[model samples]
Target: MITLSLIGIGSGNPDHVTRQAEAAMNTAEVILIPRKGAAKDDLAELRRAICARVLRAPGPVVREFDLPVRDASGGYRAGVEAWHDAIAEVWAAELADALPEGGHAAFLVWGDPALYDSTLRIAERLRGRMPIEVRVIPGITAIAALTAGHAIPLNAVGGPVAITTGRRLREDGWPAGHDSVVVMLDAGQAFEAVDPEGVFIWWSAYAGMDDEIRIAGPLAEVAGQIAAARAEARARHGWIMDIYLLRRAC
Candidate 1:
C-alpha cells in the first residue's frame, strides 16, 4: 500500500509552512515535485526550498517531474477532463517508478488542497489501480493570506461571505445572498464584469511573498490601477498568483 500525503505548503513564503507540513515532508520516504514549465519555475523552486528547509541532512528522495499542459483547443470542460486524465497517468507512472513496493510518498501542494485545487480529484483517479491511502495536511490558504496581508476580517459581523473563482464571477455574475465575495484565480480582472459602483475591493498579488503588492479602495476608483499593477507585476516576475475580496455597500 502506498500512503500519499498531499501536503499544502501555503503561499510562496517559506515561513507560511506549518509545523505539521514540515513534519510530513521530513517523514516521507519519497517526495514528488512538479515543474510547471519556465514561467512558473519559481513555484517549483518554492516547493524544493520547502523540502530543503524541512528535510533532515539525509532527507527523503526528492523527485521532480514535468507537469502536463492542459489542452485548450476543445470545449473547456472536455479539455479539462482530458488534461486531468493525462496528469493522472503521469502521476501513476512516477509513483510506480519511485515506489515499486508500496511506501510513504508526499506531494507538496500550493495553498490548501480543498480550495480550488485539483490534486485531490486527480488522486482519486489513482484509487482502484493500487492500494493508495491519502492524507491531507491543511495549510494556510491564499484567502487567509490575503486577509492577513491586509489585516482585515474575512466577514462582517453576523454576515456571510461567498468564496468563488474568477471564472464563476465572470460567467455567473455576483452570487445571491452574500454582500462580500472573495475571488481567486482571477487572471483576467473579472471584477470589470460586475457593477463597480458602490463596491469596495481589496486586492493583493503574490500575497504573503516578498514581492507582494496590495491595492484597495472603492472598485470604481482602483479597478484600473489594480489591473495595470497586475499586468506589470506579471511581466516583471513572469507569473502571478492573486486573490481579492469585494463588498457591496448598503
Candidate 2:
C-alpha cells in the first residue's frame, strides 16, 4: 500500500511548519513537489526550502513534477474538475515511477488540506485504484495568518464568521446572517463587489512570509491602497497569494 501524507507547511513560511509535519517529512520515502510553471516558481522553491530545513536527516527523496494547467475553455467548475483529474494522473504516474516498492510519499500543501484545497479530493480519487492510505497534518491557514498579521480577531464577540472565496462573493454578494467574512483565493480587488458602506476590511498579502504587506481600515478609505499594493506585488513577484477579512457593522 502507498501511504500518502498531505502535510500543511503553512503560508510559505519555514517557521510555520509544525513539528508533526517535520516528522512526517523526515519519514516519507518520497516527497512530490508540484511546479506551477515559471510564474509561480517561487512556490515550488518554497516547498524545496521547507524540505531542506526540516529534512536534516534526509531519509526521504524529493522530486518535482510539472503541474497541469487548468482548461479555461469550459466553465469554471468543469475546468477545475478536469484539472484535478489531470493532477491525479500525474500523481499516480510519478508515484508509480518513484515508489515501485509501494512506500510512503508526502506532498507539502500550502495550508490545511481541509480548507479550500482539493488535495483530499484528489487523494480520494487515488484510493482503491492505487491501494493508497491517506494521512493529513493540519497547519496554519491563510485566514489565521492574515488575522494574526493584522492583530485582529476574526469575528465580533458571539458573532459568526463566514469563510468564502472571491468568486462566491462576486457572484452572490454578502452572505446573509454573517456580518464578518474571510475571503481567500482572490486574484485581487474583490472588495468592489460589496456595497462598501460601513464595511471594514483587513487585508494581508504573503501573510507569514518576510515580505508581508497589510492594509486595514474602512473599506472605502483603503480599498484603493489595497488594490494598488496588490497590483504592484503581483507585478513584482509574477504571482501573489492573499486573503482578506471583511466585517460589515451590524
TM of each candidate vs. truth? 0.98, 0.98
Q: Give the Cα-based TM-score of candidate 1 against the true structure.
A: 0.98
lDDT of 1 by residue, 15-66 (tens): 9889999999988999999998999999988888887788896878999999
Clashes of each: 0, 0
- Residue 167 deviation, candidate 2, in Å? 0.6
Give a tens-digit lDDT track for model 2, residues 101-190. 899999999979999999999988887568899999999998889989999899998999999999899988898899999999886467
TM-score, predicted candidate 2 vs. hidden true structure = 0.98
Q: What lDDT does model 2 reach?
A: 0.92
Worst 10 residues of 1 by lDDT: 48-57
True lDDT of residue 198, candidate 1: 92
